[model samples]
Target: MAKEAKKIKKVVLAYSGGLDTSVMIHWLKANYEDCEVIAVTGNVGQEAELVGLEEKALNTGASKLYIEDLQEEFVEDFIFPTLKAGAKYEKDYLLGTSFARPVIGKRLVEIALAEGADAICHGCTGKGNDQVRFELAIKAFAPNMTIIAPWRTWEIKSREDAIAYAEKYEIPLKITRETNYSKDGNLWHLSHEGLDLESPTNEPKYDQILEMGVSPENAPDVATEITLSFEKGIPVALNGEKMASVALVKALNKIGGANGIGIIDIVENRLVGMKSRGVYETPGGTILYFAHQALETLCLDKETQHYKELIGIKFAELVYNGLWFTPLRAALSAFVDETQKTVTGEVKLKLYKGNLTKVSLSSPYSLYSEEFASFDEDDVYDQKDAEGFIQLFGLPITVQALMAQKGEA
Candidate 1:
């Protein structure tokens, strides 16, 4: 007689309660045959979506459902650190989804270990960067555990197929024929893709799909001013009132969203080496990034600031590519933390129709000295000293030019 097939005892799935993940739950159960599926949902910032997720997961064939409230950790640990580094992928992306992955992935791994599951599963497609990010993070945290990427293994290829599969299995899905955009939402941002957005030539209609932020066309004409206070590069207060991390982020999201503060459309380089067009709405993140950057400008020195800019570029790349668990990222974070020591202050910003304009910023550690920087006669800094300073500064360039002249002669 043939040996019996090895059965998967249990699997921890990173469930989003979306169409893809909803379909994945049944698919995993059917394929594995007798496997107990445990669904884990991370609450980064999808406030409304979290309402019925536990019940939905249980209804969709998950033996157990774990919804971890990770909003505070997401903001304090992941979001703030990236903000402090001034990390922006390719100059446009605030990496809202990028930073959220590691935190979620860590939780998934933790739950998988606790449950003693044979494998960890995710609904991310093989074509996307998220699959790479999720799998890499899983490997980093649990090297010995097996990873089950259903999208790569499954016959379901498109959204239509996913919808069909969900329908066949009687799985409940929020998306319908009228609204079919693939969206990823967290406390930091909400991203929209698919349909008209799939074509870069087609302009995104502001009225149709924007959920997190107000459309610029519909935004209030009056500019709204907000004051953000930071201590050692972390946002601690808003408008002179100290609030909790979660509360502050939610407040900023509300204020910035009202003013249409953060909406970015770009074709970004995915980790899978493809250019994907995405429309991101990151109201609170935009406010935080600008305010933190302005505060750093007031506190950090020229050399440190310049170097930090370079670090920001690399840091953004690392986070976007999903290499959050790597040593290079840790080293970069350490450098970023050092640069942020004096990055304490308050920044006032004017929010008007998708623009966050820094009005003024003040820091106790501010390197800007009015007496020295003033154009008018000041007691500090001698004008004559500039002549000697300029001569020394230009010495190498002068020598190089003189050498070239001598050779020409």
Candidate 2:
């Protein structure tokens, strides 16, 4: 008699309710001898996409579905720290998807452990950064848990193949070829890709391509001024109105989107050693980034501000490359947190046609003294004091010249 195959008792999947993940649910059960699948959806602000997720997961063969609301934790723990650090990959890409991955991945491990699942699965493709981000985070949190990457293992090669598989299994999916643009939306931003955007040269059609923000051409002619209040580096209010983090972000998204505030087009280096052109809409994130920067200018000292710039570069790279769980990132966050102790203030900004400009900023910790920086003579500083100060400041140069004169003498 042939030996009996071992059954997969349970598997926890990081489900996005997308076509890939939706199909993955059915495929995992079929291939693993009817394994009990547990679907875990991390709610990092994918508003309506999560509407029928629980029902969809159950219908697709998941024995259980866990829809975790992680928006507040995402904003407070991950997003705000990156914002405070001023971390931007390649100076434009704000690392939106990059920063959100660890939070989701970490939660997946927690759910997997609690459910006593043998393996954890994800819908990330073999070529994407998310694969690395998800896997690295799993290794960091649950090093012993088995990882199942369906895209890398399964027979499915393309989106078309996945769609066919879903159809064959009678699984419900919202994606179609005509409206197909692989999108990842969360509270912080929305990313659009996998259509005309695949080609670097093809110009993205404003009307057809974008979802999260309005086009600059259609933006109102009148400039919109908004005042953002920050306390300890986290955005606390918008235009003097105190609101929840989620609500504030949503409000800013509407205001910023209408004025065409945050649309970024960039060719970024993926973790898989490839460059991909992606267009991102991060309206509220743009407002927060500008506002936070303005507040830092007023609150941070010259040296701390200069050194923090260096830290910002590293912080962006770490987040982009999926090292969010490493000790170095934690240390960097500690330093960033320390810097934010004084980063409490309000920044007035003008938003117009995809531009966010700082109009004014004020903070109690401001070191900018109008009297000291003034061009006119004042009682606080005598004009004659500059002669002695300059003499002392130039002593090294004077010494070098004196040594030359001594040689001639």
lDDT at 71 for candidate 2? 94
Worst 10 residues of 1 by lDDT: 1-10
True-structure RMSD for candidate 1:
1.8
lDDT of 2: 0.89
Put down candidate 1 lDDT per residue, 1-409, tens digits, no spaces.
Answer: 0121144679999999988888888888787767899999999989888888889999889998999999889988888889999999999899988989999999999999999898898989888989888888898989988888878877998999999888887888899965899899998899999988999999998788889878987899999998999999999999999999999999999998998888999999888888899899999988998899888888988999999999999999999999999999999999999988899989999999888898999998999888888899888888899999999999999999999999999
lDDT of 1 at 203: 96
Report residue 345 deviation for candidate 1 (angstroms): 1.2
Which tens-of-lDDT digit does each residue in 6-31 have in candidate 2?
43569999999998999998888777
Estimate the TM-score for candidate 2.
0.93
Each prediction's whole-model lDDT (CA): 0.90, 0.89
Candidate 1 runs further than 4 Å off: 1-5
- Clashes in predicted model 1: 1
Task: Give one clash count per candidate, in the order shown.
Answer: 1, 0
